[model samples]
Target: MAKVLYIKANPKQASNTFLISDSFIKAYKEKNPADQITTLDLYREGIDFLRERDLGDMGDPEKLEDRNHRVFKYAYQFLEGDKYVIAAPFWNLSFPAILKAYIDYICISSLTFKYTEEGPVGLLAGRKAIYITTRGGNYSSEKTRALDQGEPYLKTILGFLGITDFTVLSADCLDVIGVDKDEILRAAIREAENLAQKF
Candidate 1:
């Protein structure tokens, strides 16, 4: 059975992003009934930030399971999967701070990625990832290109971890006037279902 980790970054309890993610999860489960799915909420769940003590014991075998050991273990759990799906809204042209913080924990040396002579190679391989996002403005135009920092940064970070295959689906102009939010959301859910069929 395949294992999927769904990361939710929206802080609001009933935000649009959460709704979109839940719809995706539902569609995914309906298609792959035998798959295992895990949900991680970056804001409400709160990821442990690396402190000075956590960084001090990088390669020390004696302190493997010390105070900050759980962080690494949790990160391993985050990376130890066949696929990942991330849902977040466009915040200041990027993701929430907590999402980035959680990523920092998982991207540690000798854990999620490793340095090599050629370059830093990703430790996790053959895993696919999907990103779902909603934006407040119409970012599809070239004039609004600056509003798309979330996708590129996520692609870079996940690619660095060896999770190469990626798919991104986004709904833009949610907050724009004279636009039908319901239709856009319905379209996104339809796309999610299509992706799940092929996932």
Candidate 2:
């Protein structure tokens, strides 16, 4: 059975984004009851930001400290997962800073990826990732697509880690005026359920 690592990046309680993510997880569990699931809530965990000292110690094994060991442990957990699920809400055209910090911790050189003569190569190949996000505005349209940095950034980073096979499930237009919020959320939840079965 696959080991799924679920990362929750939303801090808001009773949020639509969190509710939708929960729906996806429930469906996934139903379909893959034997599979193991590990969850990491960035806000609740209060992950620290990556600092210069940490980066230096990361490369120097002799200088590793307790904090560096913690970071490496996080990276090890990332490598152990067969699949990843990141649930986040759009914030300032991207994701929360806590999520970014988590990304920094996991994307370690010579760990998640390495530089080759040709270029950088992802160590975790053949794994997949699923990104679940909610945005207030409709960024799918050409007029506003350029403003969407969250999904695209996520895709790029995951690709960098050799996780090219992935899916993005987004519930947009959440904050649009006159839009049917309940309808949009319900539709998104349905979509999440469907994806989970296949995931």
Candidate achieving the largest lDDT? 2
Model 1 scores worst on lDDT over the 10 consecutive residues at 59-68
Clashing pairs in 1: none
lDDT of 2 by residue, 1-199 (tens): 9999999997786888888889999999999999999999988988999888778778876543343486687888898999999999999999888898999888987889999999999998999999998999998788998998888998999999999988999899999999999999999999999999998
Off by over 4 Å in 2: 62-68
Q: State, as a TM-score between 0 and 1, how close model 2 is to the true structure.
A: 0.94
Off by over 4 Å in 1: 62-68
| Model 2, residue 124: C-alpha shift (Å) | 1.0
lDDT of 2 at 125: 93
lDDT of 1 by residue, 79-194 (tens): 66889999988899987878888887788776778899998999888899999888999777889876678889999999999988999888888998999998998888888888
After aligning candidate 2 to the native by TM-score, how far in Å is the CA of 40 from where it should be? 0.4
Please, what is the TM-score per model? 0.92, 0.94
Candidate 2: lDDT of 189? 97
Local error of candidate 2 at 122, Å? 0.3
**C-alpha lDDT score of every prediction, in listed order:** 0.83, 0.89
